[model samples]
Target: MGGRGTRAVAAVSAAAAVLTGALAGCGPMDDIGLGQSGAADGGVGKGAALGVSPLKNPDGTGPGLAPITTSGDRAEARKLIDKVRTKGRGPKTGYSRDKFGYAWADSVDGVPWGRNGCDTRNDMLKRDGRKIEYREGSNCVVISMTIYDPYTGKTLDWTKQHAAKVQIDHLVPLSYSWQMGSSRWSESKRKQIANDPLNLLPVDGSTNASKGDAGPATWLPPQRSIRCSYAVRFAQVSLKYDLPVTTADKDAMLEQCT
Candidate 1:
């Protein structure tokens, strides 16, 4: 039995050598690292040590990250909206031009929070801007940062001077919130909505101004291609925050989504 086993091992080794030699001359099997392991065949190392090839499209680009969606609970959003819609407006809130400078607000609700405290602009600057550069080391607050504009697919090197070039857009405008349900909310809750990342997007400054407290029924992205994702985000934010949408706004959203 031992002699038969030895003979079988010898036959298998001989067959493997023959097969390896045959395959080495052609095809993808040309560089099998059998005996000359490591630095052989131009430093390819072991066969099993190769890294995975990155998946790419025919055009050689990798897939993009999925679009942003609402983070707050939808039920909680609805409750908040219901609560705020019934309430009356809080104390007259005023925003300083020095803090926002050149950024326009259409209604009292547009600048819901006072001065620089809990400003949507600052919140968005923190959330959307990357590699933030501050005016002074003493001021931990960011004066500027790199922003990627999803609307136009452009990277903007935003600075404090050009900060007005990007604006924090409310997916559901504050005035819409006021009419729908925010009128009923406490000052604290209103401030939360103002600073919510889920509702804020850094978009073209002029475009955001033009949007001006309008709902989906009245406004859509000037860049037509982004409208779908914009509508989805709008619906998600409103539904999450319990903000009521008019029939027209709902219809427009459906059209954009479809």
Candidate 2:
């Protein structure tokens, strides 16, 4: 991730007077159930006490990517990890952002947030962030919000003005997907994988960027506790897209759960 933030602040001076949420995961409205690896909007990974357990969110619909600390949850995470097939990665000869569709394209059909009017990026922001501050006259354009970031185990005060602070990460990167045989998929199928919520996470930008195109073998979240849950999420996306991971990546993923 670039050192610079990605969002363009519309009115910085005005926002100085606006209120931002101080504690993200403690409230009832922002979190409930197993949200994203357990990064549920306002709640997931609020830490060991506040986050959801991955065992409860098999579908990857929940928000945050919390750690699987319980023995049972870890075992379940391993079960999910075992489901992904192992194989060699293909070459990255003809990969590019355009290969999947414009970044966060809402028109991509057959994905959860597709055709939802809100683009996938904002949809994910709304999906995983809490105490959202939308721009005046626009609920879809989030100006700022508090996020419980599972990767670094820190609550982030983020604004669209500082987009890099909070990025919508592709849990299974697009280029990695290409190398894993997605290159052969039809454009629509590629689009589905690219925009799917199951494949996305809202995480600290630099941490997310540090994982550039790396699979589980080469990179995992810095937070050790969340590793098992991260692997489960990766496996979930792989299965959903009918994609495969490299043999080493699959092995490493399982090790996290073990």
Against the true structure, candidate 1 reaches a TM-score of: 0.53
Q: What lDDT does model 2 reach?
A: 0.78
For model 2, what is the error of residue 172's alpha carbon versus the real structure, in angstroms, after optimal superposition?
0.6
List ranges where model 2 is wrong by over 4 Å.
1-51
Question: What digit string (tens of lDDT, one per residue) describes model 1 on residues 1-258?
Answer: 699999999999998988787667533444332211222332222331211111111110111112322333323333333332223323324422222223322222433232444344554454345556656653335676666565556667777777678877766677667666666666555655555545667766877788877777788877565565566566556655667677777667656534
Candidates in order, TM-scores: namely 0.53, 0.81
Residue pairs in clash, model 1 = 77-240, 77-241, 77-242, 78-242, 84-181, 84-184, 84-185, 85-181, 87-183, 87-184
What is the number of residue pairs that collide in model 2? 14
> Could you tell me how far off, in angstroms, the CA of residue 31 lies in candidate 2 after the best superposition?
5.6
List clash counts for every candidate, in order.
Answer: 10, 14
Error of 2 at 113 (Å): 2.5
Error of 1 at 244 (Å): 1.0
